[model samples]
Target: MRIARLGPRGAEVPVVLHDDRAHDLRGIAPDVDGAFLGGGGLDRVRDALAAGDLPELEGADALRIGAPIARPGAVYCIGMNYAAHAAESGSAPPERLVMFMKSPNTVQGPDDDVEIPRGSVKTDWEVELGVVIGTRTSYLRSPEDAWAHIAGYVVADDLSERDWQLAESGGQWSKGKSAPGFCPTGPWLVTPDEIDARAVRLRSRVNGDPRQDSSTADLVFGIDRILYELSQVLVLDPGDLVLTGTPEGVALSGRFPYLAAGDVVELEIDGLGRQRHRFVAHEDAPEVAGA
Candidate 1:
């Protein structure tokens, strides 16, 4: 039930961790992903698994883990999906949910270090619960139908630049949010059968101190409604990701204390898992050879 994508960038393989051992679903059944997700291949893998025909993938600490889904077509995001977060940012709950997109290239492993872009300031963090779509959908009208298409969940951090987001660009939020490596995603893409997304505990700590602590219960739009809302405007595809949004304590939500160089930002969501990244200051990068 807990499937993992292990190995380094572009070399990852799907493996399921069962009973303290890593089951290499791909070993016995080469078509693991397609089969495991309820496709024709999925049924074949299931039948094989049921017959105890899969290979063992246990106890490999050296395996580098990648995001659960590879080649996610898009990374859609929600802003102020948390009621209190909206309030802290000096805004009212909108009549509708707010959305944005991060370049897919921004997606990286959950534990990857978040690099601070050169010539930038206002790097802030928003720890959010990520929803990955299992199938394509467009024009959905009800909340209940949303879950049927969701593949599972992952931990995502929407790193932002306040000034570039609000002031410098003259008001386009994506400019500040879409920087390369700005989005750190996944310890894994958990299937719903393994964890309860709604009951999860979410938290963010900066350099070992608690900052954003909340529950999925605090989300104003939640998953079902968010999918329905987004589907109404644009079509969502397999491997598309939705950021359910962050809760109350982001530095930009106005109490002002934003991130600086050398800060370590960490986020944890109950079953989905944890992610840590260091804030490297722009000035610290070595000067170019011909500068």
Candidate 2:
């Protein structure tokens, strides 16, 4: 089953996407979040859908698409999980996983505009497969155990600013990663049973020019191993998002120029969905009160 949130930024309503139609999910739960997903929300949605009890969301096509799931409790990212991406970044594939975190506030709707941080150059884009946890997880015995804990998947854009990430940072990468709207995810959150997460195509284009094009099959550490390894370190609660990492062909490799104002970035993952965002200069963005 495919689930989504549609409406304005802060007032999104949950819905199920089936047969190319949007069915309102307000009757099932309040919003797509930890509380909903952890509390049998998917099962309820399936039952409702099968019973034809969900109403078609009127004018859904006109509504803005929000991140499929609400802001997660945390956003974890795997770095250089693709061997080729590792090589492009001037590093060798690590024997152990390299992980980082993005502030939950960075999450945004897939098609929202992205802001190039003020005084920044080297803002780059990365298209990755996102895994959303369905239940509280910790200390899993093996990779096979990860299956029961996964809720769904979404397409994630792991935008970055190389300066803050490498040149300025003491050693950490989150400084370059946690900017507002840095992580734009989803047009839909597809349930595990609906799609094969192990093998899929991920592609990205900037201003209509092709950039990153690769497949999840190339991941140095696959989802099952990633989840199992992650569980050994930190507790993953329901609704937590894990970005499995991006492929090669990013601007960071010096093969292309960094993002600039008015640039459009389009990313797609087969079976999940596609997202397109226009880049804007920080100064050109509307100022928020208290921000």
Candidate 3:
């Protein structure tokens, strides 16, 4: 089943997407968040659908669509998981998994305006397949168990600023990765049964120019291994998001220019969904509560 949140940011209500329409799911749970998923909410949603209990959400299409899920507990990312991406970055394929974190506050709706950080140059885009965890996972026994822990998937743009990531932050990528509104995710979340995370084609475009075009098949370390490997080191909780990494074509590859104010970024993964974000100068954004 596809799930989403609709309304203004911070006040989004849960809904289920059906045939290009949204059906209210707030009666089933407050939101399609970690707590709801951890407490057997998906099962409840399935049951409700079977019973035809959900109400069609009126005016849903007119309301703003927020991120499919609320701010997750942690936003983990895999670095250079795609072999082609590693090659473009002037790095050899690593023998083991390389991971990083984005501040949870960076998470925003798919259509939200992305802020180019103050005094920034080299801000970039990464279109990635995002895995949303459904269960508490720690010390998982085998790679085979990985799929069971995933709740669903979403489209994620792992926005970055090269300056903070590589040159000035003491080699820590998260410094550049965690700016507010850097992570724009989801028009909706698609369940595992509906999408193949391993073989889907994911791509990105800046303004109107094509920039990235690749499949998850190029990943050096696929989902199963990444999950198994990470479980050994850290506990992944429900509603935690894992950005599986981007492909070769990105601003970081030096083939394209860094994103500028008023530039539009569009990204999509086959069967999962798509996202479009407009880049805005830092000074142009209004001050909000979280800022």
Q: Which candidate model has the greater TM-score, 1 or 2?
A: 2
Cα RMSD for candidate 2? Answer: 1.7
What TM-score, over all chains together, does every model reach? 0.88, 0.98, 0.98
**Candidate 1, residue 10: how far the Cα is off, in Å:** 2.1
Clash pairs, candidate 1, are 22-57, 22-58, 35-41, 35-42
Runs with alpha carbons beyond 4 Å of true place in candidate 1: 27-48, 254-256, 282-291
All candidates' lDDT scores? 0.76, 0.93, 0.89
Tens digits of per-residue lDDT for model 2, 1-291: 999999988889999999989999999898999999999999999999999999999999999899998989999999999999999999999799999999898889899888899988999999999999999999999999999999999999999999999999889999999988899999899999999999999999999999999899999999999999999999999999999999999999999999999999999999998999999999886542110
Model 1, 1-291: lDDT tens per residue? Answer: 566677766667777666666667675443223234535433454566677777876555688666666656788999888889989989887678888888777777666556678767678899999988877778886889998888778898988877888788665678888876677877767778878898689999999989899999888888999999899989888778889888988888667578877888899999987888777666653331100
Q: Candidate 2: count the clashes.
A: 0
- Expressed as tens digits, the lDDT of each residue in 1-291 for candidate 3 is 998988988889899887676889989898878999888888898888888899998998798878898989999999998888999999998788999999988888898888899999999999999999999989889998999999999999999999999999897889999988989989888999888888999989888788889999889889989899999999999999999989988988988899999999999899978889898999997553221
Of models 1 and 3, which has the larger lDDT? 3
